[model samples]
Target: MNRILATARVQLAAWPSTLGMPWLVLGGAFLVNLMVFALINTSNEDAHTGGLVTFYVVVLVAYVVTMTQYFPMILGMSVTRRTFYLATCLMALVQSLGYGAVLTVLELVESATGGWGVSLPFFGVEFLQQSNVLLQLLAYAVPTLLVSSLGMFFGVTFKRWGVIGMYTLAIASLVVFGGLAVLVTWLRWWGAIGAWFADQSSLALLAGWPALLTLVLAAVNFLMLRRATP
Candidate 1:
């Protein structure tokens, strides 16, 4: 347990990239959206900017880079694979919660200010507009976990398999998805699938599945790391 904490501390040492950059990007995106919406319309009606998507995408890339950069360093320091993996999971959870709190606050502020006084929806998107604070937090945090885990999975994959493996993985993934699409089309399940998705609560759709995926990816990442080399 101490070792895990120690390993996590090492990762946390690079706080600017892991913790600060995403929020910085989000703030910048919000300001840009605010300026654009404020200047263009000159109206009182609310607008949906969809700018928060940029922040989420950045978060995903951040985790990938985190793993690719940090894993080798820690491993070379003689840290056990298990400890490093556990530390990464810890970091992902902590960072997600921290970012989620910030996002929740921003959403509340956005609502209070009436979309920054111009009806722009930077933080408060239609689908994620939850009244329950916890749900809102989950909505924001779960995706972070999922994406971070995804990035870590890819990072470890690249470490273990190299460029050729990545290319192979990408091709395999495309084939798998394409096969699934074809199957869905042949079975005429698109409508039912759409209905199933629509029937789910927003929390279930956004948070539940992503949380499950995160766990699965974490497990897979650990497996990869167990046999991985620096």
Candidate 2:
């Protein structure tokens, strides 16, 4: 347990990229959105931008770097693969919770201030609005976990199998999804799929299913890391 925590600290040692970059990216995106929205003369109170996605993208890329850059270095320093993986998971959970809370606060402020006084809903977007604070936090955090797990999975794949492994993974994913798309088209399941999504609440769609997927991806990432070369 101590070793795992130590490994997590080691990962956090690169604070600039690991802890700072996401917020920096998010701040930049927010500024851009604020400027653009302020400049527009539309009276649409429902106007919103997907700028929040920048934070998640930065997090995903940061975890990819964790596997590609930090993994090798940490292993060289005598950390076990299991320790590193656990540490990575711990960091993901902690960071997700922190980010979720921050986002929730931002959402509240945005709502109270009427979208920063511009009538723009950058943080409190309509689709994601939740009356329950915990649910709202989960909605934001779960996707972060899912994306971080995805990045870790990709990084471990590279470490385990190198460039060829990545290419193979990409090709396999395309084939599987492409095949599923073809099957769905043939079976005329598009309507059912759309209906299934429509049946789910925003929280369920954003947090529930993604939480399960994150668990699956985390398991797979650990397995891959077990066999991965530094």
TM-score of each: 0.95, 0.97
TM-score of candidate 1 against the unseen true structure? 0.95
Candidate 1 lDDT over residue span 170-213, tens digit each: 99999999999999999999999999999999999789988888
Candidate 2 local lDDT, 1-230, one digit each (tens): 99999899988888998889999999999998888888995568656689998988999999999999999999998898888899999999999999999999999998898788887788787878887899989988899999999889888888999999989989999999999999999999999999999999999988989999998998889888999889
Which number leads on TM-score? 2
Candidate 1, residue 9: lDDT: 95
lDDT of 2: 0.90
lDDT of each: 0.86, 0.90
